[model samples]
Target: MAGAGPVVFAAAGVATLAAALLPRVLSRAPISMPMVFLAAGALTFTVVEPLPDPNPVTHSSIVLRLTELCVIISLMGAGLALNRPVGWRRWSTTWRLLGITMPLSMLAVALLGWTVLGFGAAGAVLLAAALAPTDPVLATEVQVAEPVEDPEDDSDDEARFALTSEAGLNDGLAFPFTYLAIALATTPGDWLPHWLAVDVVWRLAAGLLVGLGAGWLLRKLFFNAPSKTFRLAHHAEGFVALAATFLAYGVAELAHGYGFVAVFVCACTIRAGERTSGYHRVLHQYVEQVERLLTVLIIFLLGGAVATGLFAGVQWREVVVALLVLLVVRPFAGLIGLARGRTGPRERVVVSFFGVRGVGSVFYVAYALEAGHFLEAGAVWRVVGLAVVGSIVLHGITATPVMRFLDRKREVLTSP
Candidate 1:
């Protein structure tokens, strides 16, 4: 206990080891890896007197960078894991979730923040945008797995396909609104024109163009480079995934586009290039491992923050709104959006209820607070923190059982 530094390192090593094992250990049970890490963080921070308070308000930059790294890595993993082709009909459920469910959820949350929580328009929209994306990090159980022999049938499981694709794209798509919140907060009156042109039109276009372009080039290098030594895919190194993530994001940000969008798009484009290659599996496994480690650290810190009074000023309204956002708003909006879509009733219900919000929400709030003015920054943190905690606990408990039940039901119904 004399040197707190060594204790922290030892804790991290043990936590990483648990991260490697928990998914297999808790595969059938109601418990999840996130739940374990959260509880560990809470308990650790509560008992450890030397540990610094994990406060986001005082440490905005650290939170922003940490969450940003976690999210982009997750987006890359989500993109690479999907086996489905990119087509309107093939991804109908995903499109519905992004285009319809996302907006509806955002509007609903924004309205609640305004009327119930008394946030200004900008603050309301910021809160909504922060919590909008179904996190790619914590929802891995519901997403598609690594590449398989048949690319076309990669995601034959409809629920996995829907959740996977939805998580991949919505993180990037949510950026426009987050920027809109920033615009409204900083400039007030004269922000609309620039926002519409740059945030809406230009950023979207650039992110897509850059992501697709970079992915295509990377795929070429990986699979078809002139020299055998130059073809990285032949080497089968997993670190290329990190290289690809950083490249796509750095290029997109330099071009004034959304790096979140570009990273996912780049990953998907990479997948599209080599659908059946075993190299993708190697890359995906590595990325998944890294993501799991980061998830453990972030969620543990989140629990620590909560234990250290992150929710101290949270009111009844904030608590109720957080509950409504997770329970009522997302479910109803997802149901409405997926209505009459290809999913069966059971699948629809699963997809609707599993809109898991996590680290991405934290990242957005930190990003927004850093960029613009929000007087009620503490309140925003408390609200978003509570919402994230509720989501991790509720969805974490339900994901395994519900997904297993659906899988069983599908097998029975499809038996000849």
Candidate 2:
């Protein structure tokens, strides 16, 4: 047998090549490229005797950084992909999802965790908060693609596009809930006043303010600077996306705000700065490539993690909870939220169905575990892991076929 190092290297090379080529090969198939890679990782680890364990619990920092990078990169991509201007009316669907569906889902899941799963209040809140946001990293298929040539066609079907954009932004929005979970874990029940003052008011305000400020500063630097050398837009540098991500995130965290929100907000602000500039396209292109590469790495590692017994303690109850989250919780929450909104039935169903959980959930879980102890940490991990895996497989398989069907349906409806 080959050394583990050589085997891992070879496996990665094959995976990368397969990721690049799989979409082309499976263009007509219902299977997703992610489903294939995840399966590959699980099978490889299962069959290979020399592979080392990649458990996230023992390797928290690495997992944290990896998912963190994956998310911010996806944020950049999501921001650059959006052609719609940021406004309440323009983004009505986004607002509805953020305001209504998100809270409902959080409340429902928290209650389930508390009453049904018998988790502590903190653990229940943490689990609900962690799972509240749709993952920005893994829902790429249903999201807006790189700068659409047609301005009119830019927004994905009302449901898909709105859900995609909502996911993009709300991944950060859920940070406050995670903080609430932490507070509940650390403080007494009467800590609600402080939590309201600090966690609810200060953190949310700071994240938005800091993100807008950083984005404004960056926009000026990138596009309005006096010095030619200082004009980042002129240089078409892509790595600055990472700098922006870290800067916004670091600044927000330093000020005790939700860094995730700040990062996404900053991206959106920067994007709003020069919506029509070719420079926007340049930045987006670079970010999308980086996001793709990072996603490949995270998913592959996730596969390795699964093979290393991430799901060892998974019980039938955990499986049931995971299924309910995907099938029952999110879909119902989304549908109810969008009931009177702009989306049609097909669009509503698509949006509700494709609430794919990915890196954001991983980050939230890891962050929560690090910040607060949970007796059922193993059980939480098992349930969340199963949910993520189920999403990757189920959503991945359905995304393409469903989108194609919707497209055809739209064409037929519009035909003379």
Candidate 3:
């Protein structure tokens, strides 16, 4: 007990180093950095007898905040990584994923949770809402890597952009459904009107307004300020990415809106302006670093949670539910969503298959469990834990190879 603090600090130092180094080494390999740290966390916790249990149910509050932070920061990074300006036709893939794939996935997952997994109505909806978004954190392999400094060089690949933009928007868009679950749980009989008025309409509007407003203001300060001292772009400090992230998130929350949406919209808004500036790259890189560090902690704890029997009381059917979500529901839903879209068949398949789940899943589950009274909280946690860990292992292994194959095939098709 006396020496645990130093051990934690030392372990953190090692994790930080791994965070910095592992991405490059694992980039082309089938393995991912999240996979390595996740397994490491499980192994370390399982072998060591003195470590504190990292159960989500046991420490819901800490898990809630940590996962929340990871999601918001990662949202900023994902948003900043986009190169294309937003337009209906340009972002048709994103709209398809968010408007169609996400809701369809949620509906299917909810049905599975209720019928196959034996969850109640509220529990089923919570499960669906928890898993509504493809996690921006763990799906980095399938996402855009960084902002392009050159304006003319568009790094916009359909599959990658769809996944990244979908993850960015859906994490926030999924909130209203999450609140729907909470409303159903707490105020079942008369919840519809209140849900529509507050959760769906007002909150969504507030987030969009706050995000746009904050993004524009920050853009002015960062790029077009009259005074040199006010221009943050000149400094290139990089930490301002965090400042922008927090500012957008905080303002949106203060407006009683979805902070996740605000953070992402703010990043995209800032990015839309001055597309050629090197500042976007600096901001993206800094956000990526911070996101990676936070991810190490969350995924590590997740692996520890697994080793400590996060699925101890889980049923075989619940495991089946988790598997179905990844293998069947998401893939089919994504395919159906992308039907008639601009993506080629192969790109559609790639986008549909890599709906990776990670920190965002953890955050929603924790948030709902903490806010609403659920009898199946433990069971739900086990199923969600299964889903998230399953995703990390499954997607982590397939991401590099599949993306490389797609890249190779694209080059072949376009060659003269």
Candidate 4:
């Protein structure tokens, strides 16, 4: 046991180094950093003896909280990275993707879950709601980087920018649907009025109001304080990103609002506060590093969870549903939503192709289960696992090549 201590310490050191170096090394590769760690986790558990189990069912609260942290941190990064100001016409792609594509995808998934996977109403709803949004965490490579000076060149293209913005905002937007699943689970078959009152009307409204209010207040503190001592931007304190995330999330939840929605909205409002300041870059860098660390931990645990047979009770039908979500449902929904939008063929294809699933899905599933009762919990787990795995593998492999091709095409067209 004394000798084991050094080995463990050495392993930790090596893992940290790998985490730091892997992103740069894999930037040009066909694989992703998440895939590498996920594979490592599965292998480590399979080979190592007496390793601690990390199943989600056994450690639900821990999984929920860790993923919750990952998402909110990523939200802050997403907000800071966007150079584009928030306006109806400027963010038209974001608006269209959020308003049109997201709901269509949800409805399609829910229907498929019901008809194909034999899920009950509550389970189907939970699955659909969970899978509805694009992941803000895993899709970072394809997303826009930190605020660029030139607004015209800020994003890769309209399609990628739109997808990133949509993913960032909709991570919060999907909360109402999760709430609906919870309501269906608790209610005795007549949940329309309550769903309308709480899920649709009250919670959404409260979330928006709280987010706007909290964001406005925080923006003032960060950007313009009464005194220099209280002004966070003056000191360039980046850790406040986490502070804002938790503050917005806690306040909104306390007020019976969707904390997720509040977090993103708060981030957007904060970003809008100091659009051209170098302080925004400082804050974004700090939040991004923190988010990356959190992501590593979560993905490592997810790998551990898989080794412990997280998908043990998944059925063939559920597997089919999962595949359908990644391969059929999301792509088609994206295509339809962006039909009359600004993207060209290559851009549209890339946007539709990379609807990768990650921590958000985990949060939704856990939140739904905690709030509701599903008959086929095992099956739900199975389907979600399959979908996540498929997304990780498929999207991870194609992201680099697809992005490269698109970039090349854009260069050729714009060079003349």
Q: Write the residue-wise lDDT of candidate 2 on 1-416 in tens digits.
A: 65567766886788668767876898778887778777777787788776667788887778888888788778867876777768888799899889999999999888888877889988898889888999988898888766654545544557566866898789978887888888888774687888789888998899889989998999999999999899999998888878888898899989998777787788889878856667777777778777777787777778888988998867787788889999999999989988988888999888888888888999988887888777777877887888899999899888889988998998898789
Better of 2 and 4 by lDDT: 2
Cα lDDT tens digits, model 3, 221-340, are 999999988889988879998998899999889989999989999999999888889999899889888889999998898889899889897789998999999999999999999999
lDDT of each: 0.90, 0.83, 0.91, 0.82
**RMSD after CA superposition, every candidate:** 1.2, 2.2, 1.1, 1.9
Those runs of model 3 whose alpha carbons end farther than 4 Å from true positions after fitting are none
What candidate 2 gets wrong by more than 4 Å, as runs, is 1-6, 149-155, 414-416
Mark the 10 consecutive residues where model 2 has the least summed lDDT: 148-157
Looking at candidate 4, the ten consecutive residues that score lowest on lDDT are 147-156
Per-residue lDDT over 1-416 for candidate 1, one digit per residue giving the tens place of the 0 to 100 score: 57777887888789988998999999999988999999999998998897887888889999999999999999999988888888999899999999899999999999999999899988999999988899999998787877775765643688888988898888888889989999888889888889999998999988998899999999999998999998999999998999999999999999999888899999989988877788888889999999998999899999899899898867999999999999999999999999999999999989999999999999999999999988768889999999899999999899889988988898898799
Give the CA lDDT, 0 to 100, for residue 69 in model 1: 96
Report lDDT (Cα) of residue 378, candidate 2.
83
